[model samples]
Target: MLSFVNTTYLGFENIARKSVYTSLSKDLALKADEQNLTTLAKNAKFSKDEESSFKNTIHFTDFVSNTKISLKISDENLSNLKAKFAGNISLQEDGSYILKKEAESIASGWFADIAYKRGYLKADANNDGKLSDEERKNIYSYYGNGGFYSTSGGNVATVMATEAYSYLRAEEDFRDFTSKSLEEEFNKTLEKDSDFNGEILYGEMMSKGQMIAQAQSYIQNEGYTPPTFLEDMMDQFDQLNKKMLKDLKKLLEEKRLEQEALEKAKKELEKTAEIDIKHSNDQSLDKNLEKIENLKSQNPESQSFKQSLNLKEFSQAYMQSFKVDLKKELILETLKKQNDINYPLDMSKTKIDLKI
Candidate 1:
């Protein structure tokens, strides 16, 4: 999620702009050479391939009046740097300098440092030294930052952490509410032995009308209502049972056809993907065969292509494995090997003797 922290600062003297870019470029180079950001050996190899590929590409200038600046790093160091920041690293189209220090300050450990600290702590409520959701929200609201930290001073550190934490806490609250609601709904539907047995069973086994008739019969026989306890229990049971059945059925049948359609779509997607994969493999094989044929046609015997093309170095590589004049091959091999190694002394340095 970390991107380059790019910021533009306007109005730098031309000399100042050049000096700033030169300093940044030197720092980047030192990091590349000594630190080596790539973790894998294969990554270094990939870097080399990209390095060569860029060299083969042609770049056109947008303006005719623009002058080109040429810079060179050894081929061995080529992979360590690829285009990177050539010449001026900071200048905008309008000729402005970027403030590197401020950019670094904004970008350095922006979220990571705060996230680690926010893990265990909660919002302290009542000054009791313990944290809960309510206390955390209260503290944040009081501080105007909506987090555990105070941001009234307008300091960058407090503002950034408090703001980020406030948003995260709100998200946590929403998720917790959704989960608790689901749990409550599940619990509401749960049946227990106490809900069905003994005194309740006698009432639950009878219909509401039957219970009413029993109560009336008892009332008529005893010349009184007989408290009507069973009647009341039966009525309540009937209402609860009806509600439960309706909810259970609704949950079961909800979106049944939509679920089926989604399953059918998933199967069709898998089938189409299988066909696409087969077609892709077929095309790839054809391309590979074409590349093989082209390579074969460019063999050492292809005199016509050789006369028109300057492919001497490439031809040498192709013929390197074959038995050829040992001396000639060694010389060619040494020259080619030079492209991949660092020589200790500068080849261009000349020793001079002066009479004083």
Candidate 2:
């Protein structure tokens, strides 16, 4: 019986046992079966219990590392994290350690404790209003001072209020700085086809052609040119008319000179021709009279001689008179044609004398 009991003890020890007390003790891990102790023992050889324990260990390390809980953070690392949240460092209420301001506020933490007790910091023995130092340290570790202590001679609320005001002022100044730029205003103005304030500049009010026509009409209607004193009033329109008038005057003056040259040439030609014709006629009359005198000497009582002299002499005189009239008519006709051809522009304004 003793040998059999020993072998049974060895077999039972090789298998695992299940217990209700062990199942109740563990809430997270899978427990041994309450109804089937033999099945539990048989499955123990192929169970994941040891592998699960290792997996849990790794999970715990990963969670702690990721959360920075139980793991001490360097100040530089903490500052980098704080910067990501635009956070600042501050002391905790208990003065035990620093806290991140992004985490808590005055409405929470010791204030809650103080208010619950009676709004007095002296009621707490541990200084942080919490019952224990570790709790106070944990609260401080999480909620930092944020410079909000009364005993330290600084008011956290006032500091916070002032910082807020400062931030607002900085924001206002920054906006003003950006809005005061003239470049944007200039670009906007350049983009518009017209002027701002809905007012048109002198140039914008009228077109170039319209303005010129207006000035010309005004000058013509008023029968007046711009005075030197008021020449500054010359705009785009006035300038165009001024140039046109100046050119027209120059051309008219040139034409007048040409007309005078033509007149002089015609007069000279007529005068020379008249002189030649008169000289030729006078010589012919003199030669015919001499011939008549010789004929009279040859026949004193010849009726034919007397009649020829009277008729020939009278015809010569009449021909000379006719030639003089024709020459005068030709000169007059030439002058009339030149005057008609070289008429000045705007004749009503100024007369250009073409007569030489």
Candidate 3:
């Protein structure tokens, strides 16, 4: 229960913070026009939501703070982008280390061009094909003086891919379409699955950006976002697990009651097996010695067992052998009690004349 509360708290906290970042970003985005924002989009990088957050927090902050604005893509370019960078990609299990190694190789040449364009390499006097320690210091100092450039280095290509991938991965596949159109597109994309129709019965539709914002908002983790497709699978899995867990708990509780009933019945009848292993010190009489043992193990200090009365006095002397347990005894006592269960024994305590 505490865990659930913590998780819920964290989720809402994220929404609040994203409301900060997003609300702030909107004001920041308004400072630039659409054309410039679109151009910034070319160079801007968001560590794909699927990327490991170990280092991406820094990347995300940079993208959010320095990238200046967000822009909506034109439908024509969006189509061409969909053709090139399909939304169906998944992360490699090893955080794509192999792919990163190759990507770094490709990105190795990006800094010189990027730095040159931003005038850092152009300030390279005595041109030794690289920035000296003194030159590097000058570059850092000039960062606030309109020498806008990223220190993203080799991650540029992957960040670009991440942006493209996230852009096209809508809330649901063809989710923006009307319900009638969604049904058509879903059926068209259908392979062999019978239940693959586009009608999701559970949740309202939200786009990739909304999901990312939600993930950032509601999820307590920094720089984590679940894509639309993953959320679809997760929602189904959670529902199934929840139902299965509830059913299993109910079955367990029923089984527990049955076991408790059996124990009490066996104790009432003195039919339980002896502690054959306590051969030298087996001192129990008719096994009623431990009649309260099972209940004691569950609650050793319970007041129910505070009154010690010999079962032999009650069961062996006055009652005939029957399948009834303590529960049945209580019921019959309720039916026959003048005041209560044999509080002070008399002829009135005899419940049935069982000559039958």
Candidate 4:
């Protein structure tokens, strides 16, 4: 009876040890899963309150079975068994395994974060988390021109289609998708399509024909049918492109007309300035001629006065016509050499034109 009791006690001890090891392995697995989920929530930009709520609600103790099971296994065997179950177990997207609203938020956040980081989405310049009309237009322009993959040596339409396909597929697989992994797959596809180096050369970049070919190749390879949202986005981008081109053409025409108007105004101002200058010069010449005639009438027979009168008439006829200046010294010399003594003329206030 002593021998049998001892044997039974040993068997119980083995079973208890195995049970403890199994429980410990399960606890470790749950802890790892919790860490991964917390990391995902953090990446999705969860608030501290949200994180706390998530930890309280989504933890293994809250959602999974905790009933201990009987087992008889060695320590080495237990370690092997734990390793076998160490593979990643992802949450489902259908809300069967997780809160539907919370899961959707996380997925949306992840997509937003990826799109922003990869330059496919624009941020609010005012930091208000909302797009203004102008910002919306800019987004349309960006997409019309091909978004982040714009420089990937593909046509705008083809690049846009590729990006749309990749995004939709990733969205569909959001539960298991990560930004890093998605980015890697995108790059791989783009490199294969375009034969990318660090940068694509201008000549090696896709032409419209090449783009069409590559796009067709992509569709065949991925067996992807673009969703309605993607199709709508593509249509919107095309419309935006057409509108932009039309606006650009109209702007160019407006600029051209403005430039022509400015040129015409300048010419008119120059012509008016020339007329005013000529009128002022004509008035000055008329006053000088009147002074000369009065001097000639006062001393009609004086040779010097006659010579001065003749010189004045000659200057008005030739020098004034040619826009030349009359010499003041010559005029003064002619006046000083007057033959008459009865009348003397003061030449002090006489003005001579000096500019041609």
Candidate achieving the largest TM-score: 4
**Poorest stretch of ten by lDDT in candidate 4:** 1-10
**Cα shift from native, residue 356, model 3 (Å):** 38
Model 3 C-alpha lDDT per residue in residues 1-356, reported as the tens digit of each score: 00112121122222222211001222333334445433443453322334322221111111222332211222332233234334422234643212122222112112211222222333344443334444443331111000011112221111000111111112232223211211122122221111322222101233334543343332233232323434565579999999999999999999999999966865444322212212212232324435545545656666654443246643542332222345534444543453332422243433433120
Give the least accurate 10-residue stretch of model 1, judged by summed lDDT. 14-23
Q: What is the Cα-based lDDT of residue 101 in candidate 2?
A: 39
In candidate 1, position 47 carries an lDDT of: 18
Ranking by lDDT: 4, 2, 3, 1
lDDT of 3 at 320: 28
TM-score, candidate number 1 = 0.21
Clashing pairs in 3: 11-218, 14-217, 15-217
RMSD from true fold, candidate 1:
41.5
How does each model score on TM-score?
Answer: 0.21, 0.24, 0.19, 0.29
How close is each model in CA RMSD to the real structure?
Answer: 41.5, 40.2, 26.9, 26.4
Q: Can you write out model 1's per-residue Cα lDDT over 78-155, one digit (the tens) per residue?
A: 222223323323444543223233222211111111111121112322323233455333221110111111112222
- Name model 3 segments beyond 4 Å from true: 1-227, 271-356
Better of 1 and 3 by TM-score: 1
Candidate 2 TM-score over all chains jointly: 0.24
User: What TM-score, to 2 decimals, does candidate 3 have?
Assistant: 0.19
Question: What is the C-alpha RMSD, rounded to one decimal, of candidate 2?
Answer: 40.2
Native RMSD of candidate 3 (Å): 26.9
